[model samples]
Target: MSKGLREYAIVDIETTGGSAERSRITEIAIAIHNGVEEIERWESLVNPQQPIPPAIFGLTGISDDMVSDAPLFSEIADTIYALLKDRIFVAHNVNFDYSFIKHQLGEAGWQWQAPKLCTVRLARKIKPGLPSYSLGRLCDVLNIRVQYRHRAGGDVTATVALFNLLLAADSEMVFSQMLRKNGVVQRLPANLSQNTFDNLPVTAGVYYFHDRSGKVIYIGKAINIKKRVAGHFSGHNIQAKRQGFLQEIYDISYERCGTELMALLLECLEINRLWPKYNRALKRVEPRFGLVSYTGMDGYQHLSLTKLLKHQTCIQSFYSLREGAAVFRKMISDLGLDIRFCHFPLEVRLPQTANDLVRRIQDLPDQELYNGKVAAAVELAKADTSSYFIVDRGRDEQEKSCIWIENGKFYGMGYIPSESQSNSWADYKSELQRHHGNEYMMQLIESFLAKSNSRHQVITIDAEQLDEAAILKPVELRMKML
Candidate 1:
């Protein structure tokens, strides 16, 4: 347990193949060391109980016939434990040997875990800019003599020598920091230091990835910052660009949003503001095409899907021309508006000219009905006061999160207690934690309200029960669960 003397066990194992999940170890060697000097050494051949592929035999030079009569790992598991028990396990690519030993030990009735160091990672820091960090290439570059190339005893002895050299060169304790986070966390982006990982918050927020030149290259929103950021680098199917992205990332910055809704809205707004290279949405600056109502010279109200003209009022905006067409088509069908007047391309006999179409539209009863529908839709879409709440999953069974709004302004968001007397704004506000809300927060409220009908629970509070004074005084939250 004592690291004062820098005691470690340099371990190397020749496995049947590349994966610990599918391959079994064929040979093992260990050299216990106290930083600069080797203390004890051990080596053994093991019964892998599996056919050694010809490719592996060619690469490692360990034939199946050699280990045919060798004892199964169960026979020597006790001896392996004695060697690695408290010593920091060290290897060229430590995870390879560490994982093999750890897994094999678990099946041999021993739980094995130890502080680990990878000399590959260490050599990169001590003598960097090497073209490759593979054990063979690295040892050759450093001029460390490898007695035997693929054999366990020879490779582990070379690892021991490399470890001692790294120990002498490590002035910053990089090896110690490498072992700080246990398990597969070592898969983190190599350039991301432990200090950066330690500072990540476990809260809802928007995180930005900045490249070496301090330009934000990517931005993301997450409910748990650490897990989400770690996930970006943890997977096995890492693409070339993904690897480059990790290497290019020089710094990370984050803003904690008090609620997930705020986090989502802020992510959307920041993506639009920055237009980061990785962002796809909200990058276009042009206003979307919309269905607008304008009175023509013939005094007929016409619904046109196009860039709104000066003094024209928009009925609704659509991100794509197709969406606008669909809504316009539905409007024309619902009100029985003539396609010839709306300028829709048709195969049948069409109005000869624009003026003639306007005259036909103005002369029809359909224009009046269309105008009335537009008026009613506009009124229904207006967000005055008392019709908004941002509801998301609760922290626990007895809780629910709600962000309250009134008169199109944010009141605040907080946990809703299961036992409630009234659903008044004041009652909800008393339980709510207030925030310095912004335009994005208001937009989030509106968007959630529009989408809640199908995807979310629409909890309708009795508006008549909430008197004008109730918005201000003693709280009682009553609700009609819808």
Candidate 2:
């Protein structure tokens, strides 16, 4: 067994929200297991000082009232710090729980650092075919018992059981082999995890995609920026393509715009200004579409595909004029548009010699004017924006509540009013704006809240039910099977 499972400290925490830097931990639990057997256990309630947002209270089931009388984090920092020091910070989703602790400790004047092992990630490497490895799901598969669901002690206990199962399933040597085989993906990108993603305020913003070398490769905008980036790293085929690029990415920098429109506008501006080489799909300097205008004896002002750089707008995008013409002919047959005006015009308006035809063409569509949906999609596909809502189940007897989202980041949170001067969605949109987010943020919020699928909301709506981190869960089962 590689290094004999070295002193394991399985930990878990219930937090106010996603960000470690901003969100305070309301509860914490840890289980220390020496190589041969389990050794020690500890847990505590931490006073965050700030009022627990209603949504957070609903999610973790630990309310402001429960923790308001507890010791502040400062009071327990040293004790907790000493417990975690030098042990492998093990957790179901180590990145999420550990980050909050580290950030809190740092604020307490301690530079906390430790190696981490994620049971979620470990199970992924060891047992690749399971539908889900959430602590609850794993316990069901292995029949482990967990009592206090969302409470810190309950989660840590479950994580401890899950880790023991992992050890039993694969010897320490096997884990080492996998770790070595995976070739040093041990620490996640320094700030990419809970530090950056969880804490990211859901807001409309422009985010820059960078290589490990700290170079900007792509720029994007989103209503929830955090979700967007998480989607990129969500272990799909695309994530494999991104691994090399993302591994080189050590930092993610962002600018929060008050609205999504501004983010989009700024994204366009940044892409043009930076022209990051990786964004070649958008930056490629070839005109793929053209405009074809038919001017004939019985001319019915028709515009279709063209080849001479002076024709009507074409449907298919291509690298050269030849390809453009070929695509135009295909689109005519594909969409079943009028082919007579597109491919074979009986009477030609070409210069008998050449100069006359060129001069007569006034409304002939220019190549530059071919900025249709194809161009727009091409440009948009290069953007790196991801979005999702930060849903906190309502503490009061009300329907679930959601804050606006943008680019997988938190934009703002608030309750929608009953009598707003707008349509159903438009009212919530105005609420997002009223909360300091603008149209772009509202649009992002609207997109998520409007969806019929149940996958978008990450937190359990009841606030009483405990759940598992869905990160690294098979994308198919990550959200409800949508």
Candidate 3:
């Protein structure tokens, strides 16, 4: 934290994947700056002890062949530690790159530590109302040349340039903001600006957003409202129209809770009672269907769908019945599920063509274009039923969960835990039997259980209750059974 990038250690790392706890670093770069002057630069290739997925190789151009003979992080541990220690760790998405490297260093028996700063967060504060703050996007907007897009060295250098631009754009405000002992109190989306939310306690709490008319437009709860609400206003998801609308409001309010569980309970109570229009997460007052069950010759079998009724443990609430159904179909196809028993007409096969997908996309509100162009985008999105899997970490070191999703919807989810004798898929099947018949619970379970990466068996909760101990307890109990 200096007036002009003081002794900054702007850093970046190309990694095998996203999670530091699970993935490995493939490359690293550090650019040291004294004020605005570059003091030195360093870069290296690292042996990740894992195969570089072909997709990542294609993205970063750092392949297994390229890194096979590179120095393992252990060999360069001392050098990296010395290079970064006491220097401000800076990057585009600083935490991501920093965490990956720090985790790697720790595994190599070196505890890497450094104060961190993110260009993405800074750019949002300085250059608001942009289409994107991604390092590449920002570079393009600012006309800053980056020779390597995904490579560590290329990205670090670009981040330094971007960070410099942000500083130049608003030197007084940005620098003054940084001077605080605590992190900067960033400009919240219009409604929350009157209050310095940064000083808002990190304890569990429910935060409220009020429209200019004094109507409660949204209510949200988080373990750290300071962090979570900041995310909503951070301008990360630019395409979210609702966020823009919320930004237009002029007042904010909040209530604190002793624990995240209490915050969650309060949030559920307030959202149901207040019925805010802008609170997307809790706007609707209904359960979403997950699966449809019926009696069969063998026994009761559950079929996944999106239609939901009351009295079941609903997982995710949807905007409409159509949206819910779309989520269900996406999940069903992702899990390679059959359509016959789920109550739909037997011939309602997964749409495999542009026309079929177009019809489906026609149902959701158009997100991409003007007027009638939604028909076109749906045609494009539905052309493929790309299958994907969610890998979740389990309760113990050796255990993990695999949640399969297809086409951006919930599908069947399975659990994986440590212990050679336990079968996670089997445990999931049993849980499905007990909870599957309930429509709301089924979709909730499917969506919550679904995972894109198998890093560790992580608990599934709403974005708001991500840190609630009460909510996590059931998840842990279920994991214990497996």
Clash totals, every prediction: 6, 40, 18
Q: Candidate 2: minimum summed lDDT over ten consecutive residues — where?
A: 460-469
Per-residue lDDT tens digits for candidate 2, residues 101-187, read: 877888888888776677776776556566556678877877889888888888888878777777777744555653453323444
Candidate 3 deviation (Cα RMSD): 21.8
Residue range with the least summed lDDT across 10 consecutive positions in model 1: 344-353
RMSD of each: 13.8, 23.6, 21.8
Better of 2 and 3 by TM-score: 3
Candidate 3's C-alpha runs over 4 A off are: 1-5, 179-196, 199-266, 269-482
Q: Candidate 3 lDDT, tens digit per residue, 142-237?
A: 899999788888887887788778777875576446435213333344323424465566656788877657788788888787788777654323
What TM-score, over all chains together, does every model reach? 0.48, 0.42, 0.46
Residue by residue across 146-250, what tens digits does model 1's lDDT show? 987899999998888788778787887776666665454465444444467669998888899887578999999998987888888664432335544665665
Query: Which scores higher on TM-score, 1 or 2?
Result: 1
Whichever of 1 and 2 has more lDDT, that candidate is 1
How well does candidate 1 match the true structure in TM-score terms? 0.48
TM-score winner: 1
